[model samples]
Target chain A: MTFVIMFLEFFKTGLFAIGGGLATLPFLYDMAAKYPWFNEAILSDMIAISESTPGPIGINMATYAGYHVGSQYFGIPGGIFGAILTTTALVLPSLIVILIIAKFLERFKTNQFVKDAFYGLRPAVTALIAYAGYQVVAESLFRFSTFFETMQIGDLFVWNAIILFIVLMVLSRVFKKIHPAAWIGIAAVVGILLKF
Target chain B: MRLLWDLFFTFFRIGGLTFGGGYAMLPMLQNELVEKRKWTTEEELLDYYAVGQCTPGIIAVNTATFVGQKIKGFWGAVFATAGVVFPSLVIISIIAGFIQNFSHLEWVQHAFAGIRVAVAVLVVNAVLKLWKSGIKDILGIIIFIVTFVVSAVFSLSPVFVVIAAILVGILAGQVKRRTKK
Candidate 1:
């Protein structure tokens, strides 16, 4: 049952979450809302781990989610099977869609309708990504629910988290050559020192 | 056999080195696939990206599928997709099996605390780059703002947003063409 649900949910995600990897966030968050086995914090970990490691972010995340969710129901073998199912299901849509497009690439690649659609789609993808970044912000440094619930100033923000955010933002703009993984390493060190 | 192996290894190497998302693999793909092997050209690669963006699934996988189909037909697509995915399956299984459960430890928790913040910044940087390239005219700005607001506040389904955007784009193009005459 867990395996079947995982396959279907990820298949939906694969079919709908267009505009690339980061765009998968809202769908993943939706799954968390519906399931007890997943949580926002772990989703954040998925983003971090999936980003740093090899391969596509969406595939890595789907596999991670599948393994975790399946493990709860059937342990190790379920974990492995879940990973395979989720991955295959997630990429299946792309396999079909791309093959169709590639079949017509010579004739339709530069079609006017296609160009117009992309003209609109590209900007929307930009906004979608911005929304994804906004989500990362809300999930990471700001807990608006807690801030409202406690009605406390201290709960308003994670100061250290924001500081790290700002510093990295500034450094990225200035340095322009610092490797992305190095930034993660720095954040991990800062987190340990501040006891975040 | 050799074709499959080459497709697998080529994409496997790309899968291994790329750090962020599908887009991050662009430069490396250009270097390896275009410059080194001449499997595809710069123009074709960009087209693949555009098509991949409009298609379902990760752009990386979609791009791979298109390239594989172009080069080696059905099996090429299979080998390429499998190659790219092969790395993540192994690495993530290891993490999910062990480290992910213990990720609740205080130090690990704190590490993610800061890691998320940094990652947020990286995602923002990616958006900025996309904005520079994607958004241009008035219609583009309107679409961007509306989608961002809807997504941030209401958390609307992204599928709905993308579908509507496609319609708007088609209509806007029609209007522009008529006005030009």
Candidate 2:
């Protein structure tokens, strides 16, 4: 029963989460609020892992979330099952839609309606991704969860995080050709070595 | 049989090599599918991306599916999609298992803290690239700003925002056509 619901939820995400991988962040945020499977903190981990790993971020996340949810209910085997279930659910909608579109590929590509809709969608999708980027920054760098209780402005910022973010941003620009996984590996080493 | 296996392996390589996000897979795809394998042309690949953008699904998965369909029909799409996601299943599952077991440790938490910052930088970079490519005109600027405010501040559902954008785009296109006439 839980598995069925999991499949359905991710299936909905796959069906409606248009644009790209980051575009699915909003829906995942909603899921975090509604379900006990994962939380905002885990979502950040998902982003980190998904970004640094192979394959598309969206599919990786779906598999990760599925494993988390499934493991909670069952054991390790259940987690693997959940991963397959959710991954399949996420990909099913895309396969069906793309297959249909492929059948009439030329017509769909040249359609004025499709073109016009995408014109507006492109900017909106950009905004959606930008907003998602802000969420990651705020969640990781701000002490929002404790702000109301303490109410101290100085205590609001995670300075270590801020410093690291600035450093990484500069390094990324300077080392433009470096793979993201390498940066992540470096950050992990720095974190452990410096006790960040 | 050989062609199907080839599709699977090619996409598997693509799925395994790229990092960061879906868009990051583009260069890898061009190298393997277009330049190396000669499976798709540059323009056709762009069209796949465009269609993949508007359609419902992850862009990378959709592109793989389209490329697969173009090559060997239904089974090709199936193998390609499966191959693309295979690495994520294996890699993430192993990491998730370890992370769950050791997540309570101080050092692990510290590592995640630093990793989170890295994730933020990558996301910000992705946003900048999207802005460069997607935002073109005054109307686009307006839509971008409005969508950001509502979704971020008000926490509106993204589904509603996407639907509204499609309607507005079509309406604006119609109005432009009439004015030109």
Candidate 3:
């Protein structure tokens, strides 16, 4: 039953989370609301870990959720199975779509309607990404202040994160030739050392 | 065996190092897979990205799966996905356990506070970049604003918003087609 559920949930995520992994958030939120196995807090952690880690955020979250839920429900085998099932289900949609698209690449390249459609899709994708970013910021920065009356408006700003952002932005520009891995490494060390 | 290891290690490194999620991983992915390894050419990677964007799931994972399957087979896909997920699974689990204990600790809270601001900036940067890349024309800009306002203000389900936008876009395209004719 758990396996079935894991497969189905991930399948749905794969089927509709177009525009990429961050777009998976809204669906994952809905899943949390429907299922007792996960919650928003866990989703928050998933975002953090997913962003910091690699592959895809959606796949990573699915794996995390599967393992967490599966371990709770059954045991190690359940966890492993859940992880496998979730990853498989998540990738399945893209695999199928890619195969189909691959067959039609030449045709698609110059099709005005298809081009226009993609042109439309581009902004929608950007909006989706923005929304995902907003959600993360809201949870991490603003949610804390709402809990207490004494919390200042300034408390919600997260200066360290802002500083890191400025630093990264500047670094990205200054070191255009540098690899992203170097930036990530620097951020990770900074995160640990500054403990932010 | 070496093939599988390469598939796994590549994705594992990708998963382990990147921050700011899927889109942020794009340049890195292009660099590693397309430029560095030359496993997939630039054109192939772009096509993979396009398809990956249109399909469900994370673009990074989808790309990994596609490349993995292309390079090897079923086992390649398996190892690649595993590699991509392994880092997050370990990291999140450890954080979860620690959070259980120090969730309320002041310094920890302060740290997250700082991280939150950084996250917002990262998100803004992502949005700006996407806006430049995607919004090619006035119509695209209008569509973006309308979608953002509708979705953000009303808290509409993104699925419905996407559907509505598609329908509207198709209608607009038809109108333009008739005008051109």
How big an interface RMSD has model 2? 4.9
What does candidate 1's lDDT look like per residue over A1-196, in tens digits?
A: 7678878888999998887887788998998899776799888878767755667778888888878877777898988888888999899988988888888865775788978887888887777767767777888878798889999988989887888889899997897555555676788799888987
In the range B1-181, model 3's lDDT, one tens digit per residue, is 9999999998888777666676556556655786678887644554455556556667777777778777877678767766776776666545533444343555544444444444455556546655666677888788888877776789665556666656666677888989999
User: Each candidate's chain B TM-score?
Assistant: 0.65, 0.63, 0.64
lDDT (C-alpha) at residue A121 in model 2: 80
- Model 2 chain B worst lDDT run, 10 consecutive residues: B42-51
List lDDT for all candidates, in order.
Answer: 0.78, 0.80, 0.67
| Residue pair clashes in candidate 2 | none
Global CA lDDT computed for model 2:
0.80
lDDT of 2 by residue, B98-147 (tens): 75534456777677667667767777875675676677899999999999
Better of 2 and 3 by TM-score: 2
Off-target runs (Cα >4 Å) in candidate 3 are: A1-82, A101-107, A134-156, A191-196, B1-9, B19-56, B63-83, B89-126, B164-181
On the 0 to 100 scale, the lDDT of residue A32 in model 1 is 88
Off by over 4 Å in 1: A1-86, B1-60, B63-76, B95-100
Instruction: Count backbone overlaps in model 2.
Output: 0
For model 1, residues B1-181, the per-residue Cα lDDT tens digits are: 8988899888887776565676556655765687678998754665576566567888778877877888899999999988888788888988899875454467776776776677677767766656766888999999999988888788575677877988999999999999999
| 10 residues in a row with least lDDT, candidate 3 chain A | A47-56
Give the per-residue lDDT of model 2 (tens digit) for A119-169: 888888777767777887997789886886889888789888898889889
DockQ list for all candidates: 0.50, 0.49, 0.38
Q: Report how far off residue A67 is in candidate 3 (Å).
A: 5.3
